[model samples]
Target: MRGVTRSAQGRGELTPMESRILRAAVRLFAEKGFDATTVQEIVDAAEVTKGALYHYFDAKDDLLFEIYHSLISSQMADLDRIIALRLSAADTVRAILVNLVETTASRVDEAAVFTREMHKLNADRMAAFRADRRRYHETFREVIDRAQTAGELGTVVPADTAVLIALGVVNQLPTWYRPDGPKSPQQLGTEIADFVLAALSA
Candidate 1:
């Protein structure tokens, strides 16, 4: 397999072919369910050749992994950038929630497919996913923990519990979120941040 490549694929920063293939696969996986989607279907939808598809991915599982990996990697990058800014605890938490919601909401199809199909992932992919999630969770918790310890934030709840609650809302959002809903992801994220910050202060 050539593996996933990142070229000048418009604003998504993926290769044009890679972007089309991934989008096609995610749409098919979401609509037909992963078990029912096939490599041929993806290739046809993407308008790419079998050799082109094989050049980027070794198998169907690789496509599934990449579909999920793309979002997580982007979120992780945003988190790193936010942390580097060294903002206050509240500011940092707000940034994280907002970024996460926007990212997760934008490509909700990918998220939905992963949620329902991730159990089929191989052991290595499973471990990698778990590790990335754990790191993101722990890193957020630590930010809250440090702030509380330093007297910059209130200890209204344990940082672990707090982080869990904050992330829980975003993770389960795909089931209910609508692009045509009352609020955009940005607005919803702010409201969420407000509620969390208020709870912390109280």
Candidate 2:
């Protein structure tokens, strides 16, 4: 809280100013470290005033937490929706993986920001966020676990191993993904999912 201050129980969700500030935070935090970024720098890049920035976020740490929470929370909803569809385990897993790829492609900057700047969070918030992250990973783990029990997939793979492999494939896409490249985002997602499904088959 070395910067400005505001209330957490503001009116609605993120306002335009808050959105701008969050976007700027994502960029700056990814480019410059957390400690290196200043409120002035964020406001300057966001084209907003100090008052505007603080009106939505209390401090830089608050802004970072807000961004992180927003990203994870929304993705959880999306993943849950996809998982609720009653497809075969393999098909469901593929759909989830494809969804992940598209999501990463859509928000590579946020992904990078979240992954890189996570350590900058305060201890209390970090512990909470880590718990949330573990729950998120459990969604993937549960899917693989069910598949294993049903004998639909190879037992050679462990549940957590499936989660890691799935994440590793989807997370790496942002590093080299191009929207207008050879594959469409959906196509790339399907391809990656297919590879994972194939590997798990035997």
| Candidate closest to the true structure, highest TM-score | 1
Q: Give the alpha carbon lDDT tens digit for every residue of 1-202 in model 2.
A: 3221122221124556677788998888888878899999999999998998877777787877776566556667777887888788888888888777887788777776777777888886677567656767998798889888999887777989878977886767657777778988799888888888888898
Task: Please provide, for model 1 over 54-125, each residue's C-alpha lDDT reduced to its tens digit, 9 standing for 90 to 100.
Answer: 888888988887787778777877888999999988899899999999999998888888999999888866
TM-score of each candidate? 0.92, 0.84
RMSD of each: 3.3, 4.0
Best by lDDT: 1
Report the C-alpha displacement of residue 28, candidate 2, in angstroms.
2.3
**Per-model CA lDDT versus the true structure:** 0.84, 0.76
- Model 2 lDDT, residue 72, Cα: 59
Q: Clash pairs of candidate 2?
A: none
Flag regions of model 1 displaced more than 4 Å.
Answer: 1-13
**Candidate 2 residue runs with Cα over 4 Å from true position:** 1-15
